[model samples]
Target chain A: MMRRILSRPFAPVLALAGLLTSLAVAAPIYNAGGGAPRAVFLELPARLPEPEVALRADPLPSGRWRLTLAARHFRFTDICVLEAEAVPLGHAHIVHDGVKLAAAYAPIVDIGPLPPGRHRIEAVLRAQDHRAILGRGGLIKGAVVIEVPERAGGV
Target chain B: MLRVTSSSLKSGAAALIIFATAPPASGHEAWLLTPSEIEALALTPVPFVFASVAVLGPAAGLALLAAAVALALEGRWATIEERASPWLRGLVPSLGAAVLRVGLAAMLLLAATGGLPRHGTAPWTQSTLLVPDMQLSLAPGWDILIVVQVALALILLLGIGTRLAGGVLVLLSGLGLWVFGAEFLSYAPHFAAPGLMLMVIGGGAWSADALMRHDAPDPLTGPAAEALWRGARILVGAGFVYLAVAYKLTQPTLLIAILDHGDFPRFGMTYDVIALIMTGVEIVCGALLVMGRLVRPVALVILGAISFLAVVLGETPLFHANLYGALFVFALAGARAPGPRPSRAAWRMA
Candidate 1:
């Protein structure tokens, strides 16, 4: 039995099996305890009242629209520009019809005047790293829909 | 009986991980997500995740033992490897290097033109240096990078001034870090790895440089060659480790969210479980590359996973074109020095 197990073919096959195990099982466990210092997403628990946003869009004279946001429990700040900490203080991402339009650092931002149709604008709360912040049930976001009427409306 | 049980458990764990590794992926970087999509991800909830130390400890031990056995088995099959690996070790490295150079050219061209624009930006509207996340528009006066990228693409495509191009890539990665800050962390090491490899293995047979400088000497014979080749492997491995740790392990919600957003095929694993498995596999693969064990196979597996993610995520493969090129080089050249290693062709180079 020993001789058979020690044979070249058998030994090589055994080694290959061992290698596969090592790659699949061991390495992942080794690093389970270690993680990057900062987390991009910040999860606010149910205990903290969920933050909310309400968006208002005004057609500007320059074929653009200015957006104003009203918040209930969140504060907007640009202090966490370089890092993604699990902090609620950061900018909001302005999303236009499922496309991220811009980062609203303050209470207001400027977006497009649209191409003359109905449009949906959403404001989602974000952490310092641009990661969406999650509240009690889901994403802390608010939306508003408006009609562009015509391309010449804002212009 | 306990010993038998332990042995069985080891084999079972190995088999289980193997089964899980198949078709295991979520998606590549979803840096272009809009606000609504991000919100949906924020709402995406993971049902359950399995992280019992009881299972992990034994399996991890078995794997460590296996790695040791594999290391011991390395280079023991010189006769078989000498005959079997000539094609893999000889023809493929040069060919793979060329492919990397060409792939890099394509990526650089895309960066200059913003060809793979996603979500918010239209094609040709967003000009980033390397990734969509690194938009050059964020920094004024850096529009010069467009011309620089175009020039680099042309140079890389032709395979001339290849080493100089690699240096430029390294410099650009450093510059991106300075300009974009830590946001560039996700991309810096990955870009630097390819640049370093290009510097070491410049313009293989398929380049204008090779054609023009006929009979160009192989750079593999020097002592520095070994170190440079190893450097590329280490960098790629480190990139994997960093990504797994920063994005997946540390911020698992992000990975779970990405999986949800991409609607990745679960294969019966929960999104969180899938995230855990992916995280673990990346760590193992990356560690293998760094340790110079079973490099070709590990690289091939990583490539397959990346390709799968691209298809499932409905994104252009160009999103990870740079990684594709770097992995191809690794799969072909492997962890061994190309030829005449001061040491034996470490582990057959296959």
Candidate 2:
């Protein structure tokens, strides 16, 4: 009985073991790095060679203020705009802040033609690989303070 | 009388020990699925569970019925002299039964394969086809290989050449377990349970092997033979179950930190619930399988649960393998064998 049981077969067992070992070795590599390539913006020039700067706002607001500013190689996806707390200033916040929004992958828009007031603007970039943000992608620039004088009859 | 009773008690006890010690579920990781994905696949827990129970439960029940009928007929026909030459009579039915079992197994395999694409991404497709970074070949050719393996399993189940067929099925199942090992291991309880079941119990009395055994001595009669078969089964079953239980007991601790920290990719409430339920089912099924009493019924339930999960949770190859294993066991357990016919002295003792 012992012999019979022992003698039953070994070929299949060995084959299966070999197959399992191969699959085990292969699965992890596929799952870890399977997305799009990573990208980071090192530096952006303040003004592009060609610019009547293209500005667009996402979810056009009849009532709210928000927009994105892009020109040449610098394109922003889903930038948020807020009313400038003071006169002649505009503020922009990056929508997936600190994350490199995958090129057009992050739905950002440009908004403008502002009623001038003090404004703050920020930009961030995220890596395309699993959407990780590069280190300190956030940037704050432009009108920290703006003063628009009351002209003629306008208050 | 006391000896007979004691032996029965001992056998029953051994069966219990074997069942209880059977492995807990371990193997194969399922694809990360969301509630929306499950819904999109039109797989709700209730209907899938019902379909699973319906297919395997009835098959098991019928197999048991057939076993009971065969046992009764064996007893009544024991005295008949050469109704059709003993070899021919035995060989024909054995062949027919083997063919039937193989045919049924084939149909089930086909259905299972056909059902794969409709569900959300299978591990094979995700790992090989969709994910491009890996160097592995999607080997869409392997799908054909899988079909051939199923075909081989059918041939084996049919009992055309009992031992050879069993051996082939075993190989095919093992290869399947390996290729999809990670996936099955993650869902270990579900796949391991059925895989072990089939590995241990070949196509039962309904196969050609049983037909060949028509005139042979009762396998359970000799202590040595019984011990060998019983011990082998118990050791394998216990080993499998122990690993599973240990894994289940430790999974929460291992995964909780990741889940709570939100560091783990694709963690969700539904996946957690499914994992917990599966763990619970594995513990219970492992216990029941080792026990061996009402084995058919317990197996039926386990098979149903697996099938339900397969559909509702999205298709995993392991579930299909498990379903086949359970179905085979149910059929074998149900095959008719003679009840003990009492001798005059035995009757007097009783």
Q: Evaluated with TM-score, which candidate comes out highest?
A: 1
Chain B of candidate 2 vs. true chain B, TM: 0.41
lDDT of 2 by residue, B112-204 (tens): 344223223333342221011110122334555545645654555554444345445445445544554332232333333333333333444
Task: Give me the runs in candidate 2 sitting further than 4 Å from their true place.
Answer: A1-155, B1-32, B35-104, B107-118, B121-151, B157-159, B176-278, B291-297, B300-304, B307-318, B324-350
Q: Could you give candidate 2's per-residue lDDT for residues A9-70 as a string of tens digits?
A: 33212222222222222222221322111111112233422111233443333433344555
Q: Which ten residues in a row have the lowest lDDT in candidate 2 chain B?
A: B127-136
Task: Report the lDDT tens digits of candidate 1 across residue range B1-350.
Answer: 34333433453454444333322121235464445555555554432332345544554455456555555665663444455565555544367667778888888888889886645557888788787666676667789999998999899898887878987988888888888776676777888888888887777767887789784435454777777777778778867865665556545666766677788999986887788778667856775676566677778889999899778878787778789988887766677656531224644553
Output the TM-score of candidate 2. 0.35
Please identify model 1 stretches exceeding 4 Å from their true place: A1-52, A57-68, A71-121, A126-129, A133-140, A144-155, B1-28, B32-37, B43-81, B92-94, B139-144, B215-217, B340-350
Each candidate's fnat: 0.13, 0.00
TM-score for each candidate, following the candidate numbering: 0.70, 0.35
